[model samples]
Target: MRGDGSTPPRIPGPPVRGDGVEAIVAAGGLHNYQLELHAEYGPVVRFPLPGADLAVSVADPVLLEATAAINKRPEALFEFLTPLQESGNLQTLPAEEHIPWRRVMLSVLAGRPSHEAHFARFAELTSRTADRWADRAGDEPVELQKDLSELSLRMICEYALAGGLEPEEPGRVVAAFEDVLTEYLARLYQTDAPGTEDERRARAEEALTFLRATVDRVLAAYAERDDGPPERSDLVAALVAAGESPARIRDTVLMTLLAAHHTTGVAISWTLYLLARHPDAAERAAAEVDAVLGDRAAPDYGDLKRLTYLDMVLKEAMRLYPPGPYGAREATEDLTLGEYTVPAGTTIFYPFWAVHMNPEHWPDPEVFDPERFTPEASAGRHRLAYIPFGIGPRSCEGATLAMVEAELVLAMLLKRFRFRPAADRTITPIERFVLWAAEDIPMHLTPR
Candidate 1:
């Protein structure tokens, strides 16, 4: 009962939105819609979604911080992951219930042995991918994002399935996921007639079911076979250690796959774009990789930590294009953020991706600047201001794993070749599924 508006028009049916509303919100996709909203409402816009629902878009960091601190699950949708989480049986499903569980998961990840295993596999994947890129060191333009998307998916599957699946299977899974996601995006922006939205939702749901079943079938066999803990680290080991049920474990693994597949690919794509645009930075990264890795040798676990500029470039790229582009949560009860108070059942959509690029948080936000992340220069900056992995306790669990993999792969490729944007490059983004360039990104690669 806090804000002012003229009885907001009712939009109907599962948020079956139109191009006009989309345009009002920047119809190109969520990212653009958000930017448009921010520009129009100054970070506090009340949007009426379909089905008589209301979502208040917010970007005020202080409000975000307060809500994130006092809020618990049920209020935060993240607590209810989809499908499996809908059943709500986890110990930490609620904020109070989640403390102990979060500690356990955190302990598992924080464990030295776990980190060692992760780094070991990271090294193996680095070498394998380097070998692939090296073979095509000539005129091929490596779609850094596409390649990593597949690699991250493959690596995650290996970590979960113990490396038994054929190489081509993951591609099929990714395609199915892409189809489902694209349909969902269309549903979000389209003003479909009554039953049409239901049909689209059904398709999206089926796509998810398909993926979930595939993971279950694999995990079922993985469960019976007694493979002692993998010597090299991976998420699969975490699954075994957690002693999760087959269905819950499958959901978690697929969730992990989706997380690993999208975020890492987005970052990798941006990194390549920045590197290609700024040849000086690319050359410096190449030099660093060459000097650190040496001729005919791949980077080791130790070398990953030493790639300073490469790390900065990755950070900068993420700053520009965050993987978790936006976030949404419903207010379970009345609450006040900044100057506004929202009522119970109000939805809030906050995009850290847009905040990262806010002119206030970033200087020349659009420009690629690796120096912004240098330890000394970055010492005084707002760490929260540049959260590609997001912030609070909800930050990505696989963050460290993803970053190490991205930097190592990017550095290895740069060590061997230079990639440039293709002729007449059309980097149109399709918000259908993941925010990816609509036309397949074409880049030309040349040997260093």
Candidate 2:
């Protein structure tokens, strides 16, 4: 922070407690704090938190493009995600190990298989849930976040894991994941040193071990079944067909769970919240759903595609409240960017929440306007500006699958029940592994 708007002659962070740095990071949330810092101290500043380590936020696109795309990732800071990524059977691989595993994931998540009964299962679960929700067609306050999380949990459990789901268990994994994930995000974004970094890794591994054991039992059963042609249309079958190793099966299953359940659930939850709060958007979405599915018909895959307006509605919702909020990378070597020199070990964070809401990038950043995404209007915006899934080689592997799931589930719910905000619902976003509402997104549902 200098007299002019230049990033001070040197970065102004690495402060763990005193000097007001830690307080800012702890108070404002991660990405939001980045914007607050940039607004006061200029586009780039160093934040020093003892447990998190030294880092810089670069609002400059050219510098970020050169650095983030330079083939490096934040290994230490993201180590917190390691246990979950590995044990849950998802993305624990380094760049090299990730190659084969990711390819295998692609084989299953590719669009062709999505059209089969897997997609049918998605629609089925959603429709069944809608039927239950529809029966409550009054001012009864339903927690949109809770509802979507349950609905998404069902879809992920049934489709990605074994078909028969116990209502109590997935939450064991989901709750652990969210809790640890929240702590990890706090450590990464707010701490100055890597004090408990290793300790946190140990806890993450413990949680991973629990999930891995669960996945292993499932895998053993999968192996013992030698009777007849496999009839399951879930992720296990998909992974078995993909030839995922027994050890990695848990990781992939959990990874897909994270992708399918955690992120998409938040997106759907927020979409419902936004639409419910903004009647115009909800009405527009309801209109589309009604036209496409009428009253009682469940939307087929093609029918889901025809609900283009809902897509805009979803996009705007994600733009306002991305399920996964920010992106991070580590500087492998000392790098020079516009007016600043970054240390080799510096972890670079891209405050995507800031990017999406920038006045320069998004006009009227706070308003809910689905029309902003019309094919013509969205023509030339920066491709990276709206990274709900992420970008580059590590972008969400199950993105296509998730989108189909989201569009279908949302279309079905809006068509079946209209949502309006319920008590104790607040729009304030919280960063807990993902961008989520601080409280349950409460809403009242009325049958349409």
Candidate 3:
């Protein structure tokens, strides 16, 4: 209620009927639905989300600040991930439990030492992918998402579980993880694919068993090591040292693998896709890469800082198409957002894509201009206006590492090849765990 004693403004939205599934479906998906809802009803809209009884979406960055401290996520929305976790669902953990866990994660994932420790392996993996792309340069267009997803998975494997597997084990791990994710995602989206539900579930279970055992093998190897744990930068080592249970450790690794790979992969792929559409940005990015690495093929850990334009390009691309388009938090107390008051227990939906497109903060929102991120342009802008990673305590802890991996890969790829969209393919954005292309982004690569 406002101090003026007049009734607060009623949050405007479409008439709430049924579970809102039909409305969401009609709008294409939740991402598009949010865009339409905000466009028609303004930044804050009360809508019936499928999983929650009452949901209010906030797209205004300034208004978003009011909900930032709410640490609890709506459990029903993330319930699908329960099967992958053993100790408990990491995504919906209570704030007390999540806080310490997040600290440990930040210590390893956010530190420069951790990134530098893993940089060489990351660079090597990117170079190998580039070599494979080089082989097929002119023959056929390359599927960026599929190949880059695998590469990101491999990089996370190296970062999470340092040096415990055999030479052939990494490939097996990648295959097993893919099997696990394929089944889970298919179930979530109800998309028909090559196999029966029972068959896919069995395969996912088998892959899950292998993955857990693999983590155990690494732990066993760590236990047997005469030298102490390699470094605090190693994720597994850090978790173990912090007295986390083995089950929690395994869940952490699985969750890390799940969160890190596809998002980073799609991020790089989308950046390249945008660059392909706008050749001028691509040229500027490429020229920056050239200046940063005159003779070297890849940027070192220190060099990522120097590739400022490439960084800006990546940030802008994410603004246009964030990897995870929306997120939700359950309000723990009555919250005042502008003139309206939201009661406790309301599901506060975060329409990240819509926030990026909000004309109030980002003028000419649809324009693919990288200069929006330059220092002068970014000055005095709302902090939450461009949240590619997400907002507040529940935000991605891997944000820093993701940037390093992306910039390095971009530098390596941009230095070696020029990416142009394939002639006939239409790249449509769809939400599968992340913002993915319905048909993978196919690009024609020519050696630079």
Structural similarity to truth (TM-score) of each candidate? 0.82, 0.84, 0.94
Ranking by lDDT: 3, 2, 1
Winner by lDDT: 3
- The 10 consecutive residues of candidate 1 with the worst lDDT sum are 7-16
Off by over 4 Å in 1: 1-21, 24-26, 49-52, 70-93, 96-101, 108-112, 133-140, 188-210, 229-243, 332-334
Per TM-score, the best of the predicted structures is: 3
Model 3 over residues 1-448: C-alpha lDDT tens digits? 5677788888889998877877777887789999999999999999987668769999999999999988999987787678889898999999999999999999999999999989999999999999999999998899998889878888998898765667666667767777777786555444554688898889889988988888788777777777664586789878978899988998998888878887899999999999999998999999999998999998889999999999999999999999989899999999999888999999999999999999999999999999999998888699999998888999999999999999999999999999989889888887676888999999999999
Q: What is the C-alpha lDDT of each candidate?
A: 0.65, 0.69, 0.89
Indicate the residue-level lDDT of 205 in model 1.
Answer: 77
How badly does each model clash, as a count of residue pairs?
Answer: 3, 16, 0
Q: Is candidate 1 or candidate 3 better by lDDT?
A: 3
- In candidate 1, position 178 carries an lDDT of 70
lDDT at residue 398 of model 3 (Cα atoms): 98
**Candidate 1 RMSD to the correct structure:** 5.2
lDDT of 2 at 161: 56
